[model samples]
Structures are given as structure tokens and as C-alpha cells.
Target: MPKQNFNEKLIARLKTNPDFVDESGELLPAAVKDHAWKLNHDLIKFLLSDPEIKSTFFDEIDGHWVFNHNTFIDYINEKNFLANSYTQFRNKIGLNIDGKFLPERGEVSLVWPYKDCVLEGGQTKEAEKRKEIFFNEILAQDEINQMFDPKVLTNWKRHTTEGEQDVTDIQRDDNGTIRENLIIKGNNLIALHTLKQQFRGQVKLIYIDPPYNTKSAANTFAYNNTFNHSAWLTFMKNRLEVAKSVLAEDGILVVAIDHHELFYLGALLDEIFSMENRMGIISVVNNPAGRQDAKFFPTAHENMLFYAKNIEITELGRLSLTDEKRRDFKYEDIYGKYKLNGFMRRGDNVRKEDRPNLHYPIFYNEITKQTYLERQSDDDIKIFPIDDQGIEKCWRWGRDTFALRKAKYIEVKKIKTRYVIYSKLYEDEYEGEKAKTVWNKPYYSGQTATQGIKTLFGSRVFSYPKSPYVIRDVLEITTKPGDIILDFFAGSATTAAVAHKMNRQWITVEQMNYIETITVERLKKVVGKKVKEEGRLLEDIDYDTGGISKSVNWQGGGDFIYCELMQYNQAYMDKIQVAQSSEELVALWRDIAENSFLNWYVNAEVPEEAVNDFTALGDLEAQKHLLAELLDKNQLYVNLSEIEDADFAVSEEDKVLNSEFYEIR
Candidate 1:
């Protein structure tokens, strides 16, 4: 019989000890506390009790059996044995120089220790059956550029109100700028890099709702967790680093996340964008009723971490006030309906010592109901901005501000013995109110998103789709009509649809097979063309009435280009995924060996002896998985420079489009 893997062997050894093993024969975490070097004698005693373990793991030295603690720790921490599989290829793929793992607070910067490959996160179809490929992030500086070189785009088609048409040639403006909106189907990390060549520092807004890694939510060591969290951070860091380069100096990045990885994602963002550029964290009540299965407090909200590329240059848009908000301005005047606010500062740093310049007296003319920065008359009452408790406080405005706006905005009111200075807050002054940190609108709920999808597709085709209104509001505040918006994690293409309706150019990328069945299909509906109605014989020729289309008065009339990264080895990888039997897998393996670019560590020639060893495994899944590991991840797609190469079988039409897309002569 074949020997059990190290994980199996470790479990069996642990089961021999009643103190460590539970009734289910699983190792109790508490029993392993003493396993650390010099922690306690319990682990040593337990190991000694197992004769096989003691013989295999300990060595006889100086009349006593010596335990190799380092080896044991390595065995325990090894990727295969550890709970997270992300570190499985650590020996082959070393950490990138820039990938620093924040293990703990105040800890020295160390290599991120985890690696991400092309398939690190893209496998959303039959998620359980997909095998992952691991590769070095930055094997060498020269090699890294090759790994991220722009890839050739295929399947060029423009969808618009008229209909879909093959895009033979791309149109560019006087400055050679591609004005078409885009939707790319491929791995987002690679796509982001591909976009870096053309779109660097051009995207106005990037909004993403990436995977929360909710499985690891229970663990509180979010920033420092070795397995799942580390892997997640590594994946995020790779993409975010590239994403930052693609953003305009005054651009904004908004990431929607829940409680699970909030702190961890926040820390990572702080490291990348610097905490100084962090704009605000908005709490959106996407589920008003709250999640029923929550362990403690029912979660009714998720947070959006907003950051500006350069805070100094960033300008935020405003929202029109509702009728209810207009009521807040209670008083009326020739200027507009207004409200009175005391000029005295109320919050922290209100004392005269904090702002001595704002502590000066304001002389009030009671008869004229006017205020001045200086003494107008000897009879005029001087207000020092004192509270009822006899404590001094500084005015909200300085003397310069008082002089600049006192004629139009200041009003002095006398009540009993004291004269009070007030600033007239006009309704027109706040015609467009700044968006607050909380959004509890009913339209922002996840249910609204679900219902919208149902209206479009007649069923809930995607889960947790963000309400298009949410994207609409987000786009409203961050971009203009022609600004470029990018969403790499393009679930259901909500951002793209909203951007299209709002007249902003957008680019969204998705790797899931559903991108065809759901993402693009949804976009097609949003672009709107003649479609057969369910109840009538006539085909309705109109824009999609669902989502933000009606809200924005969108009678859609625009176009977007849909394309994908030209697959090279990725095509063979797909065949590997669907190969049913051992016979099919063997045939695919032979083809891969002849045509594919094998990984750096893999030898092209399979030794006759190794073939016998592989056959002996007698497992189809195992053989298929082993075959997948041999393909080089870096060559998943054909690079743009290699379009002329006959080996990749690039079509003549694709060559023309590629040349035009890249603006190459």
C-alpha cells in the first residue's frame, strides 16, 4: 500500500495520545501549546510515548534521545500540513522583494512568505475541482517585467444600441487616446498590468468588492494570521500595487468590505496609499434587517474604505439635498431659507489658548442687529464668547473671516443681559450637501440588487450583487461624464452597467466563466437592443429599463468594446480541468509536454522511470493535478510582442486589432 502523506502521518501519531486527540480522532489545539521549543515537557513526553514517532523524529545523542525542534516545527508549519494551501510552493517560489509580510505589530519586515499564481483567485466555476498553479511573484527584476508584459487581446466586438459588430479597427482621438469603454475577460492581476501601459494615471475611479475570505473570519489575528489572511494580503498587495500605478493623481479608490477583513485590508491600504491619503470610511446599511446567522451583533452594514491618490489635489462631488433635509433650514431671508448657529466653537480645542487669534471681542450694534470686529461705538456691547458656566471659548471664524463675510452672513441677537453672535446658514449655501459617512437608504440594500438582476435575467443569476444605485452614487461623487472607471472584481458588471448609463467610460475585468453567461450578457442588456418580449410576438427595441437606467433617465445610446486576453497555455489548462478519465489526462499530458512551456523547475523530458512512478499512483485526479503543475504560469496568455510569432497561431485579423489597440506603428 502507498504511504500516507505527512498530514495523515501527523494525525495518526497525534491520535495515539489520548490527551491530544478528541473523540473524533482530531488533534486538540490546546495539546500542541507545549510543542514550541522550551515551552514545556508535555509534548516531549507524548512523543516519547509513541515508539514509532520517537524513533523516526528523535535521535540518540549523549545517552539521551534528542528532539529536533526546528525540524518538527517545520513539519508542522509546512504548506501541505498547515491549514492554508497557499504556501505549498514556498520552496519553489520565493517571496518578492517588495512583498513584506506584516507578521505582527513592531515585528521586523520579513518576506511575505506566501506566493500567488495566475489561478490564485480566478477559479469561480466548479470551485472545488479547480487545481491551483503556484509561481514566484518576482523571481528577478528583469523577469518580472516579462511576466507582466501586456497581452494580446482577442474577440474584439463593440456592443451598442444598434447591435453588436466585429471591431476590425480601433478608433483613436487626435492624441491617440482610445475613447471606447472596455470589458476584459481574464485574470484581473494580469489585466491590470496590461492596462498599466496605456491607462496608467488615467483612471478617475476604481471600485471593487473583492472576496472577503469569510471562512477565516473567526480568527481575530487578521493582519498577522499566517495562512489564509497572509495569502489574501499577498494577493491584494500584488493587485493594489499595480492598481495604484493605474490611478490618476487625483483619483479615488473605494473598496467595499465587511467586518471580517476590515482591519487587515485597512492596514494594507495604509501601507500602500499612506494613511494620510485615506479620505473616509463610509458605513452602508446594505441589509437593514440584519443577517440572521451572525454570531453576535446582527450585521446590517458593510464599510467602504475610500482613499484619494493625492489628498491635496482630490476634489469630492456633492449630493442634492432631499425635501426633508431642506426643512433643517428653519428661518427665511432675502438670500434663502436659513438657520442660525452660534459663532462660538464647541468641540475640542475651543479654548482661547488653542486659537488666540479667534478669541478677540466682537462689538455688537444692538439697535441695527449687526456685529463688527472692532468697537464701532462706546455704547456698543462687546461679546467675549462666554458660556453660561462662565468659561471662555473661541469663535468658529477668525477676524479676517468675520470681516470678509459679516455684511452678508453675520447676525447679532441680544437675549436678556448677554449679546450673542450668530452666522446665518443659508439653504443655498448647502444646495449640494456633502455625502455623510453613513448611507442607510432603502435603495442601497442587497435585496434591491437581487430584484434588479431578476428583472434583467428573470432569476437571481449572481449572489450579493451590489445595487446599481450604490455604484451610481459612488460614481456620482468620484467621476465626471467622461472619466474612466475600472472594476477588476467585476461581479455581474454592476459598475460597468452603472458607468454606461451615467455616460462615464468604464473598464471591467472578470475571470469566471460566468462572465460570458452573466457579466457580458448583463452588459448587453444594459446597452439595450431589440429583444423578444416574453408575453408578446413583437421584439421590443429599447434600452434596458432595469437598474439605474430608469433612475438616470437613460435611453441608452453608447458603445463598449469587449475582448479577452489571448489564451496560450491557458487553453491547455482549460483542457486539463475538464479531462475526465486517466486515459484523457494521459493524452493531454503528452500534448502538453510537446507544445507547452513547462515551468522553470520542470524538466521537459519525462524520464521512463518517472512515468512508471506516476502510473503507480493509480489516481486520475492526482495525475491531472501533477500534469497541471508542470505548465509555466507566466505564459498563460500570449504577450503583445509575440503576436507576430507563428508558434502561438495568432490570426491575421487579431494581429491588426492588436497593433491598433496598442497603437503600434
Candidate 2:
């Protein structure tokens, strides 16, 4: 039997990384790896013409490798030879009555009109051909080796670094569950790119509250603050592209933005989701505090756009209560658990091919009290077997179903080709009216934060959180129990906390500082944590007046793994360029090793035996240390050095020909 595949998602992920490269600064080989399409791992294995690519370019410690863009490009082209492979595929398809020969350079073109007829990408052959060429060209370009729009990458990385942001990393626990919580940092561009694997066609619902691009001088929008109209639109556009992929066959995509970006976002949504999936736009009155604007109408309403992947004539029920409604609701089991449906059974409305055994209904024999259902000739009628009771009631079901339904069904009551089905309820049964185009629910109404916080947590260390009632209301309506709820703009983790309380896991990512008092404090109170802490986290989150100070200043407290996104410094890169000899390189490394802000405590010692040429330990003063065992050509050890004195302790030993060891350093 063929084994299952896990590399499918990983393969898809590799297709997204343009800057991914080998040690020589060339494009990385396209192989199965960390990122692959969901389930494709079974179909394809991770491959690499050169498997040591990561160590070559990423590590940069190996001196044998040199960064050369042109050479790397050549290698990528050679490695991607299959992309240029072409073979005729025979196909039989349709044409118009007079035969429609599409025009040259039509917007769309067929990939292999013979084997598979999948319409995707664009319509023009020229366009598709151009795409093929462009894709190959993109693969061969050296631009990928450069910083990805440096300013954008830097700002995003800086904003979403470990301590500055809170992003939950989750994955599907089982295939049965469709929903999952995802929190991604870095530039949303890169983050979304990575998500193509796990989420393509798998997301059931998406709700994004993006920045509204309102360029109001007094509005005050910034990196960490909020987005102005153009900025927000651009950001949303990039993120939506990936979000669209995660949606399921019957999935939905929703966006939350104010008037500033509503019109534009609506247009963009139409482009990606298409007008068919565009269920409708909802106007939410979020703010009760009206801005008294003298010049224009004060901005108040925000848009909640809804879209679904597919629409069908599904006879869904109305509400969960009511006498008349329950009457319409049918039951099949003893406990009334198996509700009966009125729709034509799977075969209700069928073509002739479906009911081959069905014939015209026959009348019952009143005098003989015998039933005859199937068509019979003179001889066949005599053979029409009689029931033991001598009363034959003609069956209403088709001939083929007579035996099957007879075996399973014990009809208690029956009407003219219909049963007492449970569906479509009256207004009286519901606590409120059925859903309307306008959502006037308390969640949408806003201004309930104080009450909700007090109810969920009585002044336990947090305040002014979103109402879980509202989040629950929306989830009950639009989402299933298994769906992933993403709140990138989550204030106090209201959405996630609500989702969790409802047994729905969620991902909450926030960048505000004094996080303990804001998102942290709220989550602690909301999650109803049992563990008590020694000290407070960050004092508050609303202190920053703008995006950030650019110096990677953290304004919060509490225990969190401290880390910041970092890259090679240009000045250091220049110094490395000038150094041609190993001695110079060593000196350069020494200078950087001593000067960088690594916050090293020299007394830390290296460990006994941790990794090759390295060890973790505690030094004389009892600080953490990392020791590396320097080796010679025959793999002979030379000396041990401390990499991070505060992190590890180090010791080295000399070994004999037979692998006997002696303490060397």
C-alpha cells in the first residue's frame, strides 16, 4: 500500500519563497521540505540536487561556499528543468454550434485542453504563455537574494518580533476538524505566503479587521496605531490573497473596515471572492460616542462584509423553538433524535435513468382486498402474490425501493407522497426574529465592554474587554465549533477568549506594549488561570503615541522569551567584504563578538558534551556557557571557546588513535 503524504503542504510553501537561496546566494533548490502542500508529501518526496544548501548560504560559516547571483540563477534554471518540459496532451471537448475558435491573445488559454479542463489563472493563451515565461523568469532572477522591500520587511519584523507581539502558533489536530486558530507575525506578506499549505481550501470562515485608509491628519494612523485608507487597503489586499486560499468549498470571507476603505475593499473583494460569493455588506454601528464634526458627517459605521464560496438551495430550519415549528419538524427515532426530512429522499427529483423500476401507480383491488403495485400482464397478474391477511395495499414507493424501504421503514403515518417533516419554523418559537440583513445584535451595537468584563471577570486585573456575548453570537451564526478564529487586531483577546470559552480554539496576535495589563491581563482573567504570578507584566498598552521608536524598545513586562528580529548589519557586511584573509576574518568576528549587544555574561561556562565542536555548561561563576571543540584536518581537537558565556560552560579533550580521551582545555 502507498503511504500517506505530509509533504504536500511543504511543497506548496517552497513555491512561495522567492528569496530562499543556497549558500552561494543563489535560488534554493525546489525540494520537499518544511513547507509543502497539504497531503502532497505522499505524492512527492523532498528533493534537493544539493541537500546541504541551508548550511551553505544560511549558516555562512563554511568558507568553501561563495555567494554568486548569476551562477545561482543558472543552477536554479537547470534544477527547474521540468518547468520547461512540454508534451502534447490529447483532449476531446466542446465547441459552439458553428464552432467557436477563440481569438488570438484571448484573455484565457488552455493548459492541456486534452487531459484536464481546469479553468484557472487567466483566459488568454498569450497571458498563460506569458505567465509560464514570467514564472520561469522570476525563478531565475537575483532580486530574491536581496531584502524583500527592505523598509516593509524591517518595519514588520520589528513590529511582530517575539516579545513585541503575541501570536499563537497552531495546526490542525485531526483531519475531521475543519477549523483552526492561526497567528502569524513577520510581514503579513511572508506570513500569508507560508500559510498557503495548511489553509488552502480549508478555511470555513475568515474575518479580518484591517486598517481603514483614512488619511485624516487628526485621525492619527501609524504602524502600531492603525492604517490610513491607502495603507490599509494595500495591506489588506496582500493578506486577502492568501486568506482566500484557506476557505473551504462552502467557506466565507469577511472584512471589517470603516467607510474610508469600504467601497474600495468591496471592489477588491469582488475581484477575489467574485460577486457570487459576496453574500452582502453589513453596516455596524460600533461607536456610540459620536464625533461632533463641523465640516462633515462624523465617521461612525464600519462595514462587515460577508461572502461564501458556494450557494445552494438548502432547506435550513428557522430557530430552535415553537409549537408550529416543531410540528413541521419530523422525527424518525424513538427518542425523537433522528429528525425526519420532507425533501425528496436522495432520489426525489430524478431522471428516468434513476427510477428504472418505477411504473404508473395502480389502483387497489377493493373487492378482493389485495394490493398490486408493479405492472403485470395477464399471466403475471395471477402470479401477483397475496399478503397473508388477504389485504394488499399498493405501495407508494417505486418498485426498486419497495424491498429496501420495506426492510428499514415502519411508517407510523403517511400523507399524499409526503411525511410530517420538521423544518421551516414560525416566528413565535424563536426568542428573537430570524436573521435579518441588518444585524442589530448587542455585539454589533458595541458599548457593552464594561458589563461583559465585569460578568466574565470581576475586576480581576483587567477591564474594558470586548463582550464575549457578541463574539459568541456571531460564532453561533456564522462559524462552526471547529473553525479557527483569527484576531490580528485583538485588543484584550476578547475574540479568542470567547472562542475558547465556547470550546473553539483561537489565535490572538497583538503588538501593543505593557501587554500584561492589556492583552495579558485580559487573557489571564478571561482564561481564568489558576497560577498566580510574582510580579506584574507590562504596566499598560495604550502608552505609545505612534508605531514604535525604531530602536526595538519594549514597553511591557512579565515573563516572555525575549527576542527581536535581526539581520546582518551593513557596516559589518562592509568590513567582511574588505577582509580577504582568514586572520582578518577572525579579527572581524572577534570585534563583532565583543561589540554586539548580545548581553553576554563572560563567567558563564560551557557544558560537557552538547553538540559537535560545541558544548553547553556552567562557568566558574555559574553562568550558562557554550564551548566549541576546535578540530584539525583528521578531526583532531585543538581548543575550546566560549560562544555565550552567560548561556553555557565548555571543556575540551584530546583523543588517541583508538578514541581514548584526555582533558586538553
Candidate 3:
């Protein structure tokens, strides 16, 4: 008889014994059930036939079939297998949306609308045309690595007294030690990785207010071109992974996010920080009145996700008591100011049956007016928790606990012939209230954030900047003086300003053009002895010194180093920016072709002779424009490894700096 085919034999065996596959054990590639059990046989066979899919997703270990975790994720992403229903794919992989399961979804991909579009597609034809003309291209792994590879921190200029005053002497502390505060101007992800060379595992606190990506035209803070859900997740994942590596063992990460991506960000955090290290979510009400443009209930609050590198060693700080809280401790005694607390467990499950051990009675001396934990041979007097309303209550502490710490409790007075027992909680013993989950106070609102930036710059240059007070409050709880604070999304440098005022070292990174106009200017103002407006120190104008600057006694003395990421493609870009006419731009294009290394991902099919062909085009302006567009803007920074290439002339000084910065021989 002829041997049955693989699938036929497997199906017959499966019918006889359901566990015939032995999924947990090693099996040869021919006999292995690599695809999900629910998948169609034809689909499985088709996937296995594709060389890329088979080689990437399926592996052989000692001639035994094995699955490649990361490659499988890539395969799923490339094929859009989970496009129809995520729940179906998740169930097949034994994973839920929260990333919890017997086998976790190690990597994830969201269904982006325009992800798998081709030039010949129906709806994507216009987009394909736009790509042929001008559109952003996502950089490949090699291109991204080469573009962001470590470069020297050059053009080190320090600001001390504002007014563009450059101080050569570094400011030293009382111990004659000089601390460096950094303001980096570049892509935050690349900057963070570069910073890792010197700051790995040294940062104490990281507070970031990343772009909310609201995808609303009304939201001015959103990026010009909205990143799709999948791209946004990937962007955050890359940065957060690097951020996690730079945090000290007991360090804390606090991210401020809105309702738009809060759930998605939370899931990402869960995957990165793990459930055990998640501290808690704090709801901060930045808009009490609520935003008016909502389909349902208007959003009034944003969430702050807190996580620790090592929860076991992490210590939470407390907030100082307010005047209203101080009034509660009115009574004073030899033990100092104390508050009388009812010694009964009055909330849910307060009955005798609820807590049998705490149901025991305490002895009260009617004459001495003192309560004792135990009854002295039934002669000392008994105090049962019967209120004036004739309701029974239970003791706050158990019998053994109350016996050991009876000095804290006292019988104060008799009310309607029944002795009233109380516990004296002293003021000195109380540090402060633990920070609550909900922050609805007026100071935590967006109005305060606006007022803060206005106070510093005298104009609202940045939209929706975070309040320095709120950042200070977070720092007070998570970090101490002299701790290193980092903020990669330093839009207006509010985190750095707060850190400087609080006497902590800080590093801030910003990529926008306003880094110099808004962020750097604000930091200079923070260090200024006097506020300036219109390039002149203002004395008559009533400037509102409302933020932490005044309270922290900030003066123009401390210094911060300012640096920009070295340029590669931007050098050609500079020429493009300053081109007087189309002819000059055409010449600059030829210069780019010779000197600049184009990103491999940027229309690699375009012939090198296209530059010469563009010059012959009748529309000189269009030819110039297309030439400028041909270079990828994303490959702006020259990799340190490529600095020595003949195309990029490396200066000896910069070479030394780059080598030392990366600690490379």
C-alpha cells in the first residue's frame, strides 16, 4: 500500500488520539505542527511554501522544529494576519489584550490603515503618487543605526547670566565640585541613546510629557503628520526601552498621557515594566471644566503612569500637611499636639462576627478616666462600644495589639453616662499625607501650565506646557536634591527648570526648531538675575514671578551646556535652504550626489544619472525642488563610524571627541 501523505496521516492520527502531535516535545520539520491548530490546512501549506516566511518564522534546532519569537512577530506584521480580528489571533497565541497568558505576546503589532499599501492599489494610488513626488519614508534598521550612531558633543557653549553671556569658568558648589546640566538639541531617541554612554543606570528620576497624539486638528500640540497607532507604539517602545536602561535601580519613571492613548500606553508599560514593578496610576485634573469638543463625556483629566526599576528598593516621599490638615491636631499634651481619634472600627465589617479576635472587651477605670486593653480580674470596670445612639462598635486594634500599645488610647470624657474612649495621634509622629490617586486641585490645571510659560517668556510661545509646580510636586515625592532628572520630551524645558530650581542636576532634549527660541530661552531666564523682555532687562514692567523660580530663590549664576547633534544630510539641507535660484539649487544637488551618503531606504531604484537628467528638464524650478526632495531628511546626523570616510572630511579634534564619547579606541 502507498504511504499516506503527511497531512493525511497526521489527520488520521489526530482522529485516533487528540494529543498525537505532542506539541510540547521536539519534532522534525516534516512532522511538526508549526501553525495554529485552528488555521486552515491550505493557508498553512501556503505560508510554509513562502521561502521568506518559512526561513524567518520557523527554525530548526538539532533537526527539531522551533519557532522564532521575534521573526514570527515580524511575519505577522508583514502579512497582516491579525487584521480581521485581534481577539482571534490573541486566543490562538494564548494571550489576552493585557499581554498576560501561558505564553506571552512577546512582540505586538497594531493594525495601521495604510501599512500594506502598494503603488498599484485602488485607494492608495494617490498616496503612491504622493510618495513618487514627496513623502516621508520610514528608515530601515541599518539606515537608522548609521544615522543615530554616537557623535561628538561639539560647540559646547555655557550660559550663566543670560543676555547671551558666555561664561568660560564653570560654576562650582560649596564643596568646590562643578555639576553639568545639559540641554541637547536633537531627536530625543538618538540623544537618549548617546547620553547612555555617560548616564547609564545613573538617572534617579525621569518625567516626560510626550506628544499626546490626539489626532485632532484642534490639538495644536499634535505632530504635523499624525503617526498611525502602530508607528506611535513603536516610537514609544523604542524610547521607553532605552529610558528603562538608563534608570537607576531605585529610579522612578513618570509619564503624562491623555485619554487618547492612555490604555495603549498602559499596555506598553505593562509589557516593559512588568506588573510587579507598576507603582500606581495618578489621575490629574488639568481641565476641571472639561473640553467642550467631545462626542460623549468631555475629558477633564489626564493620567500619570508611575513605574519603578526596582519596587523593593523604591521609597515614596510624602506631601507636606496643609493648613486645613493642621487644624485637625488642635489638642496639645506632654506628647505634643495630638488629635483624638475614635477607637472603634466603624467602616464595613465592623461587627463582632466580622473580627472575632477584636470583639474582646477593654477595661475602663471610671475613677481614673483611663482605658486598659485587658480586664483586671473583672473588678476594674468594662467598656463596651455602645454609642449614644445605642449601636455596638468594635475596637480599632486587636486584643494583643491593643495590650502592647495601650498608652496611645485614653478615656477623655463621659457622654450621657457612657465613657468615651479615644486614640491620641501626635502631630510630630505624623510626617505627611501620602499622595492620593486623584489630583483635582486648582494648581494642577492647564491654566496654571499656561500661566507658567507666560511668566517665563512673557508670551505663550509653547502650547499646553506642563506646570512647573506639578513637576516639582512629582520630584518632591520621587527624587531628592542632587538627584539626576531627565526629560526627553522637553518641549518648554519645564522639567529642567523645575529640577534646577529644586537643586537637582538635569538633562533635557528637544528636537523642534523652537528649542533655541523657546526651551533654551526659558532656561536662560531661569538662570537670569533679572527678567528680560525685548532683549533688555525690564525693571518697570510688572513681571509675574509666579512659578517655582521665586520660591526657590533662583538667580543668574548656575550654568548649562548647550549642544546640537552633528549634521550629515543637513549640511546639504543648509545649502538647499539658502539657494538663491534654481540654478544654484541644481549645483547644490550635484554637490550632494558627490559628498553626501544617501539613505539606502530612499528610492534605491532611482538611477544615479537622474541628477544629470533633472538638469535638462525645462521646468528649472521643479527640477531644483525635486533635487532637494531626493535626499532623505531623516538621515541628518552622520554616524561616528562614517566620519572618517572621504566623503565626510573628519576634523582631528572632532574625531578625538567622538572616540572618547563612545569610549572606542
All candidates: CA RMSD (Å): 8.9, 24.5, 13.8
C-alpha lDDT score of every prediction, in listed order = 0.73, 0.36, 0.63
Candidate 1 wrong stretches, greater than 4 Å: 1-9, 13-73, 76-145, 173-175, 216-227, 322-431, 530-541, 606-624
Return the top candidate by lDDT.
1
| lDDT digits (tens) for residues 1-665 of candidate 1 | 22245467666766676755544454543245233444357778877776766776688998799887766654554434533222222222321123321121111111111111111223334232212222212223233435588999998888876678989677666766677889998878888889887888988999999766563322212221222344566677888889999899999999998887799899999999999999999999999998777878889999999999999999999875554667878988788889898889999999888888889888888777777777888878888978889888899888898899998898877778777888898888864768899998888998899789877787556667798888888998889998989999886899999999899989999876677888898888887876556755344457678877766888756788999999988787668766677678767767887888876655666555556555554655445555665666678899998998989888888888888888788
Q: What tens digits encode model 2's per-residue C-alpha lDDT throughout 1-665?
A: 11112223322444444423333332234322212222233322322223443332222335543333333323333322222111000001110112211111122110100011112332333121100000000111221222222111111111211234422221235563424333322223333433444446665556555434343421213211111123344456656776777666776666766665578888888887777778777666555544456258775555678777674521112223323344544544432423343212333533334444432343333244333455344422222112234432222356565545432332222345322212222233334335445554444444465445444434322322344544555555666665666555555566755565545545444433323345555444433322224754433443221111111232321221111111223234335434444445445545554543211222122222212111111111000001110100011111112212332221121111101111112
**Model 2 TM:** 0.39
What would you estimate as the lDDT of candidate 1?
0.73
What lDDT score goes with residue 227 in model 1? Answer: 27
Measured by TM-score, the strongest candidate is: 1
Q: TM-score for every candidate vs. truth? A: 0.69, 0.39, 0.64
TM-score-wise, the better of 2 and 3 is 3
Q: 286-396 in candidate 3: lDDT tens per residue? A: 889987777899889888999999999999999755556779999987779978888877889887778767776678776665667666554567777665676666788
Clash pairs, candidate 3, are 527-556
